[model samples]
Target: MTRTLVDPYSVPDELRPYLQEVVQRTHALCGSDLVSVIAVGSVALGDYRHGRSDVDVTVVVDGTAPGPVVPELAAALAHPALPCPAAGLELVVYDRNFTARPSGEAGYLLDINTGPLLPERASVDPSESPAFWYVIDRSVALQAGRVLYGRPAREVIAEPARADVLTALRASVREHSSGEGHLADNRVLNGCRSVQFCRTGRWQAKRRAAEAVAASEERFRPLLRAALHSYERPSRTAATTLPTTDVHTFLAWVAERVDESSDADRRG
Candidate 1:
């Protein structure tokens, strides 16, 4: 039942209501302006964790909505009022061009970041955000996004390909490795997934990627396990066992792997 609307259903009964609300609200706000509503990230990958993972969604419109419309939609869909059953609903609105193509810059109409795990914020300015996460999210959306409304995902979204992903991975690893206020568990698991992506050029769930890497890279098993343990738990302090020093090392290694992959990709 969880996988009905899309492949490999991950949404449980508890999450269905909240997920439905997101679709309904977006339709209500955007109306005929809405081009597509695609579900991305953990939920699309069948790795969604209730109270842990975000129900990431992307809304594609023909063009920019009325300025006030975006703000209203953001307020309408954000936490407390709508009550995201999962950790939160991360819904981003993009024009058809942005949704259909990959850009190296942060170009979005609206970003609603809400949930208990995250600070509540509905950002309309793309200049205030980084481009890497958006690019990565777009790539995932291109490959795996499930259409919640409007046109099919493939018909509307364009592929960002492997090269774009590796570049984005490099940028992300660099930031998480040195940037302040990043989650340690996220760094480790993301490292595992990035390394796997570098090696295989395939995208997958963080838990799946970590498991695959742990099976092959014996040296990082303990760290991966710690990260996986923390990711599975809903508590904020779940990463207590995740070593800070090792996480930096892992990110560095992942950065190097991304570099190698990037170089190889360029050569080929």
Candidate 2:
């Protein structure tokens, strides 16, 4: 749906008027016919820090006419007043065809149908799936941040979801597993973060998945022995590769099982 959390009064003094002016100018330029324009990412979440964090904005329009509006909106945001001094602005344009889809993370969705502004939705409850953990984990650490629209940061941080929010963490670990070396290293790091969140019940499934990953390690002697009990040799040469696609897929499947079990435990 269309959600806008603009609070012009909350912007910093030096940046306040400029942002409001830009919004006004953009509205005038586009005849204000678009759907909603809300601030998201680090800034909207109030975790932004200066000299870091871009001015993240989302302008949801009515039709498929985003192509025509891009240049106008960009010019307005980048005008001399703001000049996009810091991390620059990320602009996303979503039309009616776009629907909120769950982001594999608890209650979160991929949000934008297209563009570079695929920032996660800020949930009211920190425990909701697809909460800001992805952003908290990946987005450049905010030196400072402020809301320029809709709801207050506290409000957004208080809403709860149907399930704990860590499911997305597990999904991210599985989905982005192709690269090796440093990329593989990043995946492992993210996997570790997922584990941390999961351990807190924010992401129950992810915690279990992390446990499974830890258990597979050569250092976890007893767990490895247990794994060896049920392990069966695959009939192919490709099966033994540590970083193979098959291995990742298998890990993801196992992770899903772990998540399911965690859910069952909660139910019981």
Candidate 3:
């Protein structure tokens, strides 16, 4: 089955051919075990901007697929001939069983991100961290993502519960709370999305989520605008350059909001 969230005509013409080629190559590599290839992230959310967004993809495979499939698939897709669109490609390959009920262990067989500086691969080992799962469980993965092959996205994905959402947010906050290192612009916006989801029950792309919260939460406006500006720009260097102090402040606020939301949920 094929399911598309956005009209093919709507996507910038230049991106369409490249994205199609990527999908075709992916289908060729995964073969029969591939249950579905869904497009998540900004592209599916109608917020796609040519140079600013990454083309995110999720390839679901049969639970029983061979162990070598993932590594092989990764190598195959990582070929230099196949150029990526936007900032880069963010791809995750998940087993069907894992999609239904993700475990503490890394549910994905292959998780990779590729861009200019990191052209060949991105070392996002989900086994080492649960943050990957937190980002995957966002409602947009199922509700708005485009299915390029096999089963429809809705049939393949199991949306996380409210409790699960809170857990994920808390984990993210803890991981990023240390002020020693700076936070990426996307992480800041992701925090906004999580907080918004807890309070409003709406899933949004980063830009929209940041905008929504900035409008309502006066304290976050300047920070959110900074992030938004960075996100709109084409280069990583153009991204937000917040100081360590601001980064810590934002993370601490997110942690507090998450704690309060979780408490409210429990009390209710």
Best candidate according to TM-score: 1
Error of 1 at 178 (Å): 2.8
The model with the greater TM-score, 1 or 3, is 1
Residue range with the least summed lDDT across 10 consecutive positions in model 3? 1-10
lDDT of 1 by residue, 1-268 (tens): 1222342244566776777677777777777887887888887676777766778888889988888898889888878888877766788888887766756766888988997677888888999988778888777777777777778777877767677777789888988897476678877777877887787766789999999988998888899888888888875555465677888877887888899989988899
Q: Model 3 lDDT vs. the true structure?
A: 0.69
- Per-model TM against the reference: 0.91, 0.43, 0.84
- Residues 1-268, candidate 3, lDDT per residue (tens digit)? 3333234664557578766676666666667777887777777777787776677788788875576665666766663656665767778877788777633344666777675534566443565546535354435677787766668777877776667667777886676665333336767887887777777866677788888889988987888888788887876667767655776788788888989998999999
In candidate 3, the residue pairs with backbone N, CA or C atoms under 3 Å apart (3 or more residues apart, or in different chains) clash, namely none
lDDT on C-alpha atoms for all candidate structures: 0.78, 0.41, 0.69
Evaluated against the true structure, the overall lDDT of model 1 is 0.78
In Å, residue 46's CA in model 3 sits off its true spot by 2.6
